[model samples]
Target: MEYFKKILRFAKPYRVYALLNILSNIFYALFATLAMISLFPMLAVLFKQTEPVFEKPIWNGISMGKEYLMEYLNYFVTQKSESGSPGDTLFFMVAIVITAFFLKNLFGYLAMYFITFLRNGVLKDLRNELYVKTVELPISYYSEKRKGDTIARITSDVLEIQHSFLSILELVVREPLTILFTIIAMLSISAKLTLFVFLFLPISGFLISLIGKSLKRKSDKVQKEQGYFLSILEETLGGLRVIKAFNAESRFSNTFKKSTKRFYNFSNSLLNRQNLASPTSEFFGIAAIGVILWYGGQMVLVEKTLKPELFITYMGLAYQILTPAKAISKASYGVKKGNAAAERVLEILETENPIAEIPNPIEKNTFESGIALEDISFKYGEEYVLKNFNLNVPKGGTVALVGQSGSGKSTIANLVTRFYDVNEGTIKIDDVDIKNLKKESLRGLMGLVTQDSILFNDSVKNNIGLGKKDATLEEIIEAAKIANAHDFITALPEGYDTNIGDSGNKLSGGQKQRLSIARAVLKNPPIMILDEATSALDTESERLVQDALEKMMRNRTSIVIAHRLSTIQNADTIVVLQKGEIIEQGSHTELISKKGAYQKLVEMQSMG
Candidate 1:
């Protein structure tokens, strides 16, 4: 319920729709009760049971209003039967019943109509917030979380909230009001019988509540299994090539089947429990009706304390209570299921981001001096990945980092971009601690191109334009020319308008890398970070991409993480790292002259 209330805040903007739904439901409840009560007058007329009335019934106070209204209705029926035909009196009573029923259904439709806006409005707002949070959260947040689970929260959990929580808007007012109004009508018919009805209600309610006790816990398991299986599906799709190449389809299939079987079991348990709600509540309702029949029979047939017509009407009103009671019972189960999903969704919404920007952070737009990692130490979890590591790249100069795997080259890029903060020491840009700078403004000062060219399923032009939101087509073409991608792009079926497919699979590796370089060139930032950008390409592709990289890095402050040392031989400075510490640093020629780790790595690659 706590999470339920938190989700309800999303509906505040559509309160007018909620208010209108409530208003319509009130009238619907009134008509629903009146429609049932109207049956009594018709029965009275058909059986010729109405008493004679010589004079008009007098106006009475609220307590005796029911008695006065009954007498007045009997008096009118008597007049109609006396003045016209008995058939006319029957027709008039039937018309009253039909009108009550018509109004009931009319307002019922209006109630549903008004609530549609509120339900969909909350859904749209909730999804929009989820998407914004997904993009705003630090990249490290995803390192330990499944992408599919996050997708499930935004998609499935939100739908559950709509099914369960938002639906409360319909059930909360209508069902309770229906039950309340019907109970009042029952009391007006026979207070003694109504009191007897109340005795059985609490017992039935308690029993029904017992069924829902374990529903939330079970529902939580079901939702989590749903995320688990979805994660498997996402992973399988993303790694289909590897699975086929290794001939490990059977392994992944068995794993997926196991998850699905668990999901099937959980879903069965949850839905079976939910299905039990309707029949259980209905059975209790019918049991209560049976008890009423026994007691009310004594009053009407044996004791003569109640009228036959009114006793029949009392039974009708009593049965009317069951519909709303059943509805409320089902809604209770829905709320339980919805509550579990809400908790999962709120977990993400309420998470505190460790990399949050400080208030009044400095907005740095220029790189006047250089980027410096001063005695920085960091770790992903337990052991340090970068321990007291330091490096400097002055403006308009390239500093290349060459190391084997896990040597913290990429960690430097992440820390400098504020993707993750250093556990100890500070990283400063132009001597200003990067922690003091606004993250967006700091990232705005640099361009990044990684080993895998990250392109989206969009047009070639749009992919390049991603570097600058409002980049013109001419700007895109000029940037492409600079990165040597303009010729291939124009040769495509639609040229700049060509769809790149998923992750730009439609283009070759080198073409994709060039587009990435072109995107960076379009941004034209003062600082560029290349993380083994040409390591994955073939010799020809590497040459072309290296040419593009050199063109883009000519006058920019660049930090190049090179897996192939030959690419950085002409760099202004080369730093060789081992494990997590820098072992050699100098110009490329000087490092080779030292006959150290850098020289050995170059010799090893040459032998390969």
Candidate 2:
């Protein structure tokens, strides 16, 4: 309910629709009670038990509204009895009852019709807002979360909210109003009987509430287990090749089975609790009906205190209350289940994004001087990955950082692009601190190409144009040519329109790397960060990709993080790092002459 209150604002926009629905429901509830009460007069005519009334129907100096109503009905029946025949009176009463019932259903349908807009509107807005928030959240958020869990939130849990929570508007509002109007009609007929009906209600309600007490907690556990199994299934599908290659099918199957077994037990418990609502509520309502019969029968058979027809109408009204009461019992269970899903969705919508742009940030257009990492330090957690790091790549100069794995080579590239902020010290670009610049303006001046070719399942033209949206077709071709991807693209059946399958799996490793280069080339920013761009390629592919990289880096300020020694041999300055500290810094030839860390790295690579 707390999370539901948070999402109430989304439903505000559709208040007009909800209001119309409520109005329709109000009329429907009123008419439904009238429909039941109308049958009483017809029963009086059929059973020949009509009450003979006095002129003014004034009883004990108080005007009985029921007697006045009965007087009016008797006047109509008496007029028709005099006009043609007794059958005419019966025909008139039947027409009135049938017309009232038809109208009851008509308004009921209209209420549901109007509510459809409100239900689907909330669903659409919830899904859209979830999508927007998912993308706006920082990348660091995903590092600690499973992708499948997020997927379940947006898909399964949201759907549950719609079904359980949003649909409550229909059942909770209309059905309860219907019950209230019917109860009022019953009370007007005989307050004592209405009071008796309510006496049984509280006991039934208490028992129903008891069944739903732990439903939310159980539902939350079940949803979490569902996500766990989904994540395992996602992982199994993604890594089937590894599982098969290592002959670990049984191992993964056992793990998945364990997860699913827990899901099964939890799901069964949740469903078992929910399944209790209908039967228990119906059983209690039936018990109340039995008590109504036992007591009301005495009033008719022995005391002669109540007329048979009015008692029959009273029974109809009492029976009507049972449905909404049962629906309320069911809806209570639904609310409990929806509470869990609502909490999950609100957790995402209410999450504070850690890497958002500052208020009134600087708007730098282009780099003029260079990018500088001045005594910078960073860490993913408590362990420092980059400590006291210092580097300068002047405008139009190429500086390469060559080191073994875990030496913070890629961290330097990440900091340069502000993909992450440094924990200590500052990174300045063009003599301005990066924190001061608008993130968009700062990123507009740079391009990045990671070793994993991050190509989507899109067309070749679209993938390249991502670097510079709205780029012309000719510009795309020119960039592809610069990346040495034009030949392969042109050879494809659809050329630029060829769909690069998932992660460009349709293309070769070299072809994919070339396309990634083409994307960066199309952007043509002043500064570029290539993080092991050719690391995963074979020798031939590396040479081609490296050649394309060299071409792109020409006359551009580039920070290259390379694992291979040969690729950065011609860099203007090559920095060597050890244990998050700069060990050597000079031109490639100068570093080789020093016979230091750089020399030892080159020697080891040559022997390999």
Candidate 3:
């Protein structure tokens, strides 16, 4: 219930719809009760239980409102039957019932029409917020979470909340108000019998509550198993190539089958308990009706304390309670299920972002002097990848970092881009701490190109122009020519408008890498961080892209993490690293002359 209220806050924006729904429901409930009560006079005339009043009844005060209305109805029926035909009176009574029912259904439809907007509106807002949060979360958060689980929350779980919680919300006013008005009608006809019906109702309510006690727990299990299987599906689709290469399709299939089996069992248990709501409430309602028939029968037939027509009408009103009672019971089950889903959705929405910025943070838009990494230490776990690491890059100077795998070369690039802030120590740019600057402004001054050329399934022009919004066609072509991609792009089926397919799979490795370079070149930021951009390319492709990279880095402040020793020979400064510590730092010529680690790496690469 607490979680349910939290989700209701999303309804604030759609309060007007909610207000209209409530108003319509109020009229619907009134007509629903009146629809049944309107048939009382017809039943009285048909049963011949009461003598028709030929004289008009005097106006009665509010104290005798029920009695006054009864007398007026008898006098009206008497006037209709004065033509010596009771058929006319019965027809009039049926028309009154039909009119009451017509108004009841009309307002009922209006209520549903208005609630639709509120329900879907909240769904849209909730989904939009979840997507924003998913993107805003740090990359490290996904390292421990499943992409499919997040998708389930956004897609299936949110829909469950809409169907369960929002549907129950619709019933909250209409069903209970129906029962309230029906009970009022019953009590007015016979207060003694109405009070007698209460004895079994509490017992029925208690039994219904027992069925829903464990519903939330079981519902949570079902939703979780669903997320688990969805995660497997997402993983299987993402790694289909590797799965087929290893011939492990059977293994994945068996794993998915096992998850689905558990889901099947959990869902069955949940639905069986949920299905009991309707029959259980209905059975209890009939039992109450049976008890009323026995007691009210003796009062009307044997004791003669109750009027036959009034007792018959009271029975009809009591039956009306059954429908809303069944609805209320079903809604209680929905509440439990919705509460479980609410917790899952709120888990994502209520999460606190660890990467937070200060109020009124400084906005540093340009890099002037240099970037300084002083006394920095970082660790993904207990063992530090970088401990007390220090380095500096002067403005417009190209610095190359050479190291083996797991030697913290890429870590430097990640820190410089603030993808992951250092665990300790400070990174300063132009004498101002990078953390002090607005992240957007700091990133605005830098461009990054990674080993894998990340491209979307869009036009060649759009992919390159992603770096600069609304860039001119001539400007896009100019950037492509600088990156050595212009010739290949112009040869494509649609030239710059060619669709790249998924991750640019339609293009060759060299062409994709060149397009990535073109994107970075378009941005033209003051600082460039190239993290093994050509390590995955063939010699020919590397040569072409390397030429483009060198031309682009001529005047930029570049921090190049290189895997191939041949690529960084002309860098202004080359730093060789081992185990997160620099073992050598000098020009490529000077490092080769030193006959140390750098010379050994160059020899090893040359032999390969």
Candidate 4:
């Protein structure tokens, strides 16, 4: 319920719809009760049991209103019957019943109509917030979490909340009011029988509560297992090439089948328990009705304390209570199921972003001097990835970082981009701490081109234009030409408009890399970070991409993390790293002369 209230805050924007639903439900409840109570006069007309009243009943105070209204109705019916045949009176009573039922259904439809907006509105807003948070959260957060699990929370679990929790909106107001009005009608017909109903109700309620006790826990397990299998499906789809290459399709399939089998068992358990709620409550309701029939029978037949027509109407109203009671029980189970989904969704919404920007952060928009990393130490968990690492890059000066895998070369790129903040020490840009800058403003001064290319399922033009929103067509062409991608792009069927397919699979490796460079060139930032950008390409592709990189790096401050030693020979400063520490820093010519780690790496690469 605590989580439910939190989710309800989203309903504030659509309060008008909620209010309309509540108002419609109120009228629906009134008509529902009145429709059942109309049965009394019809039965009197059918049985010819109505007593004729000689004088009109006078208007009385509120306390005796029920008695006065009944007398007045009987007087009216008697007068109508005296003027016409009994068949005419019977027809009038049927018309009244039909009219009452018509209004009841009309209001019921309106209630559902209004609630639809509120329910769907909450679903849309919740999904939008989840997407925003997914993009805003640090990349490190995903290192320990499953992508498919997050996808499940945003998609399936949110839908579960809509189906179950929002359904409570319909139940909380309509079901309870239906039961309330029905109970009131039952009491007016015969307080004694209504009191008899009270005796079994608490017992029935106790039993129903017992069934719902473990429903939430079981539902939680089912939702989690859903996420688990969805994670496996996402992983399997993303790595299908590897699975096929290794001939591991059967292994993954069996794993998926096992997960789905468990999900089936858990779901059956949950739904079966939910299914029991309906019959359990209905059985108790019918039991209460049976006891009323026996007890109320003695009063009408033997004791003569109740009228025959009124007793029949009282039985009808008593039965009416059962439907809403059954509904309330079922809705309680839904609430339990929905509560579990709500908890899962709120877990992501309520997660505190560790890399959150500070209040009133400095919005640095320009770079003048240089980037300085002084005495920085960082770690993913316990052991440090970079311990007391230090480096500097002057404005408009090209610096190259060379290292083996896990030597903290990429970590420097990550820190410079503020993807992960340093665990200790400070990174200053132009004599101001980079942490003080607004993240967007800080990132605005740099462009990144990774080894993967990272193209989306969009047009070739749109992929390149991602670096600079609303870039002109001419600008896109010029950027492509600079990256040596213009000729190949124009050769495609649709030229710049050619769709790239998934991850740009429609293009060659070199073509995709060149498009990535084109994107970075379009951004045209003062600082460029090339992260092993040519490592995955063939010699021909590397030569073309390297030429593009050199063209883009002119008059720009660049941090190049290179795998191929030959690419950085012309860099203004070459810094060689070994296990998070700088072993050498000089020009490529100077490093080759030193006969140290740099010279050894170059020799090893040349020999290979």
lDDT of each: 0.92, 0.87, 0.91, 0.91
Worst 10 residues of 2 by lDDT: 54-63
Cα RMSD of predicted structure 1 = 1.3
Predicted structure 1: lDDT: 0.92
Instruction: Give the alpha carbon lDDT tens digit for every residue of 1-608 in model 2.
Output: 67767766778889988888888888888888889999998998898765444344444433477777787677666666667787888888899889988988898899889888888888899999999999888666888888788888988999889888887787756888888888878878878877876887788888889999999999999888778878888888878779999999999889889988998998999999999999999999889889888888988889988888998998888888888888878888988999999999999998987667788999988778988889999998889999888888899999999888999998887777777888999999978889888888888999899999999999999999997878999999999999999999999989999998877889999999999999999999999999989889999989889999999999899988988888998899899988788989999889878889898988898833
RMSD of 2: 2.1
List the candidates' TM-scores in order: 0.98, 0.96, 0.96, 0.98
lDDT of 2 at 253: 89
Off by over 4 Å in 2: 51-63
Candidate 2 C-alpha error for residue 544, in Å:
1.7
Model 1 clash number: 0
Comparing 3 with 4 on TM-score, the higher-scoring candidate is 4
Residue pairs in steric clash, candidate 3?
Answer: none
- Number of the top candidate by lDDT? 1
Which of 1 and 2 is the better model by TM-score? 1
lDDT of 4 at 28: 91
Tell me the lDDT of model 3 at 182: 94
lDDT of 3 at 75: 84
Cand. 3 Cα-lDDT: 0.91
